[model samples]
Target: MTFPLLLIPGLNCTERAFVPLLGSLWPLASVTLVNHRRGDSMAAIAGAILAEAPPRFALLGFSMGGYIAFEMLRQAPERVERLCCLATMARPDTAEQAENRRRMIALAEQGRFDQVIGANFPNTVHPDNVDSLELRDLHASMARETGAETYVAQQRAILARPDSRPDLAGIRVPTSVVVGEADMVTGVDGAREIAGGVPGAELTVIAGAGHMVPLEQPDAVGEALAKWLRR
Candidate 1:
């Protein structure tokens, strides 16, 4: 059986972030890439996405999108048929993490957005792929396209997002937590935390990948998502 799939991209990431997985997913599902740049708060962003989303659909959220996903589940648990959290965590940002985001926002505001994007590009992929011009350029392109304003807003939203740990146990839908074994941003421990909280949630750790697992190891990440969608 086939169903609608709603995808929420990460901070400063456009639909381009999921392009690699689309080939494997297109035939198995009706996919929609959500627009999450319009709102400054998690609630506002989730509400806007829900207002335009299908009545019910499989939901996949990556990075900051996971925060919005939690908010959506809180607002309308009945609307999500299944959930996939990719390279994300259920906890709110730590003080250090929040500080880093503030620094990035400041850099963006100072018209050094390119530097901010460049610095983050290497962290998105595994060390082996850090020198890959293709991945680096793609990351930069996506960030530039997303623009500084949206980037700042997303950083702020993520910083202010509520801790989703308590709500995980209440999630009734089928759930999958996918993360890169080498993820520097959220790390495997974070993924484990989410999987442990959600009843019967499956955990997929993709080796040789990092924060941007979908792009770093497209085939592996695609297979993981396809399996979850089939389940």
Candidate 2:
């Protein structure tokens, strides 16, 4: 049977962020691209999406999207048949992280959007992929498509999101925590923390990848998702 799959995009990302994985994974299920740019708080955002989501479906959340996924589980655990947290974390943003987000928000508001991404994008990929023109442009495109207002809203939601560390052990679905071995954004240890927190959660570290593992290693991400889908 084909299951419904809801794919959530990260901060400054739109539907394009999952383009690489679509062809490989779409055939296995009916897929939907969530509009994560709507709300300024995690609760509001999660509630909005949950209202539109299928009764029982698989959820794949990346980066800030993972924060929403956690909120979704908290609100309605049975609705999420399976979970995949990619290049994300369970901890609430630290003061330092929130300040950084505020700085980025300021830059975008000041009409220095590209500059904000220029300053931040390089560190989001593997050291080797940092110089990749395609990768850089893809991210820039996604950010531009997401625009400044949504970016600010996403930052606020991420900033106010609850710490999921205490809620991890309650995840009762088949879960997968994936990260890039070289991911500086979330890191392998964070992936391990999520995996260790939930019962029977599998951890997949894509080699030669960074925070953008879904794009940086589409084949591997596809393979991992395929395996998760089987469960």
Candidate 3:
């Protein structure tokens, strides 16, 4: 039987975050997009997904979703058949990063999410995509759907996640790390860290892409996933 596949979205992201890749890959596996809006901690978010997931499954997570994926692995390694992380990190939030999340939460509480979105979108896409209407609209719609409360919840969750680097050295499952070469948020360095620690894991960097690598280069991401599945 084909293993179940769980797709986890980033901060303030919904199922639409996987829409681009889903069209091409859904037929190959049972794909479920796990929601991250309800939980205020990584453990809680991972627990929610674990509660709803099948007995054994493959996990594909992007950005903040990747953090939850790591937590899931920590929670139950045997249940994860395969693992993939896109534009994510294994380290806990630095003091500065934690401060930034706190500030974002404060802004959300003050009803300044529009400002938050404006500031965040530029960092989300590559420079070439900064003016792309499709990218802008997609991100705008995602942010709108997520709303301030969800964003705050995700930020808090991310800030509270433990450093996962130590855990990576022990992950025995097939693993892959995908990243955008131009990703500024969680750059190639983060991807390298993950791939380096996970024995025999592959790392793929898509050109001309940024933090939103899955959305920016869906075909490549899909191909990578398909290859991993076939292995």
lDDT top scorer = 1
Q: Is candidate 1 or candidate 2 better by lDDT?
A: 1
| Positional deviation of residue 191's Cα in model 1 after best superposition, in angstroms | 0.6
lDDT at residue 146 of model 3 (Cα atoms): 88
lDDT digits (tens) for residues 60-114 of candidate 2: 9999889999999999998999999999999876777789989998998898988
Every model's TM-score = 0.98, 0.97, 0.97
- Residue 186, model 1: Cα distance from true site in angstroms: 1.2
Q: Please report how far candidate 2 places residue 188 from its true position, in Å.
A: 1.5
Superposed by TM-score, candidate 3 places the C-alpha of residue 27 at a distance from the truth, in angstroms, of 3.4
What TM value does model 1 have? 0.98
lDDT of each: 0.92, 0.90, 0.87
Candidate topping TM-score: 1
| Residues 47-107, model 1: lDDT tens digits | 9999999999999999988889999999999999999999999998788888999999999
